[model samples]
Target: MNMDLTHVLDVAQLTDVGKKRDHNEDSVASDVSSGLLVLADGMGGYQAGEVASKMAVLTIMAEMKERLAGSSSGKIDVASGMQMESTLLRDAVAKANAGIYHASRTQPQCAGMGTTLVVALFTNDRVLVGHVGDSRMYRLRGDAFCQITLDHSLLQEQIRAGLITPEQARFSNHRNLVTRALGVDSVVELELHEHDVEAGDIYLMCSDGLSDLVEDDDIYLALRTLNANLTFAARHLVEMANDNGGYDNISVILARPRQPYSAGRHWRHRILGWLK
Candidate 1:
């Protein structure tokens, strides 16, 4: 996690309050210095959602920076058997959950508050993604764009059980009905995924606001058209979501991996792929 940020990855981020919401309840952060990225979508009344989302983002960023500091890299988490980067990302999210949960329990305004989280960490040649609730991560490789993180939502479950189809679920009223969320309970289970990084790979982490309103094809189109201008890509995504009703807070973080300087880096990735 402590790699030099010298032309390693291209990163851009954007967030919007949306037309329907009076205040933005989503938070996003990208720290190329620490090779960390995060996004959170919050739900609650009395502005607790905003508080929860901000708290989640700040806590996770701080924890990740601290944990990835020095040369620890990371160690295998016994329960999950994941590599160091994965374990560290898991621990960072867990730490954020603890902080948010503690505040919700003690603060009257924060009672029953929670947020959905999606975090990604970049290492030398891999990406570790961890998420809770419906916040998602998608990877666009060449002409292919597909979601990488499975959602923990009732709608997703119904689709998996064949009770509903993807098209049906899309228009279903359960778009915001997440089955799992941070700070909702004392403990939460996170979904973790890993992928080998390749040059020109584009990763998108976003809240449900964009996914619920904008079609996947549209997202792909924006990224494909504005791939070179990440700033425009991020803005266009939020703009597209708003045009489609923008029923909730919108947030996005885009990252593209860069080629390594040393030829040995390619060999290293090949070795990692072989191990996988």
Candidate 2:
């Protein structure tokens, strides 16, 4: 069954060039009806970063929307044993990567362009999240707020290897050095995961600009304090990042599940209405 997320989820997104950057290299796209949201942070020469990011967001959004419209979400992939939604999201990212990489190689001005991506597809009472590079996704449930996606960056690897603590990594000069990114290579792996959705759960997808400058504690406070107003919360987050020096382009997508959404619910509601 196809479910419309317009009423099921409350979503808002915002992007800023920040104080240090003359041009914004970040991009965001969403289809509330389709429950798809994507954010990208690009890196390269001149305006190539902006181009790469826009390409990534557009490609993934278009590809996923078309594929999902023709396919069944519950169908399981024989090779991966994952749901169709998961497979579709992965393939969509791969297609975006290929398109970006080809453009970077064929177009001189776009040479060396690459982008970090984070995407979320909400359906059947769950959210399928996929990402590459250092862009991230965070979830806030109750008083607990945490990062859902791990950054594929040098600092993250250092912290994982015990070479540096989380606190030290925060101050490390290698924070912007991502180990993986789309368009950087011919083939990029998209990390995918599925999470059960709960009412009142808020998910934040953002570029490093916000995460790097805004402390996690501060983010938690902002999100919790303004959970009732996503638009304000989103703008406030961007403002906080800029207030902290805004060293990079900041982008954020805030999504809150207003109610449990299941494909079967549509049919059930129709049947009950007809009987009544």
| Per-candidate RMSD, Å | 4.7, 0.9
Clash totals, every prediction: 0, 0
The deviation in Å at residue 193 for candidate 2 is 0.6
Please provide, for model 2 over 1-276, each residue's C-alpha lDDT reduced to its tens digit, 9 standing for 90 to 100.
357889889999999999988999999999998899999999999999999999999999999889888887667889989998888888888899999999999999999999999999998898999999999999999998989999999999989999999999889888999999999999998999989989999999999999999999999999999999999999999999999999899999999998888888766987999999
Please write out the lDDT profile of model 1 over residues 1-276, one tens digit for every residue: 365544778999999999998999999998986668999998886899888899889998988787777444445667878676677677777888898899899999999899999999887577888899999999999999999998999999999999999999998988778999999988889888778888898999999999999999999999999999888999999999999998889999999877742325645766999999
The TM-score values for the models, in the order shown, are 0.91, 0.98
Residue 179 error for model 1, in Å? 0.7
- RMSD after Cα superposition, model 1: 4.7
TM-score of 1: 0.91
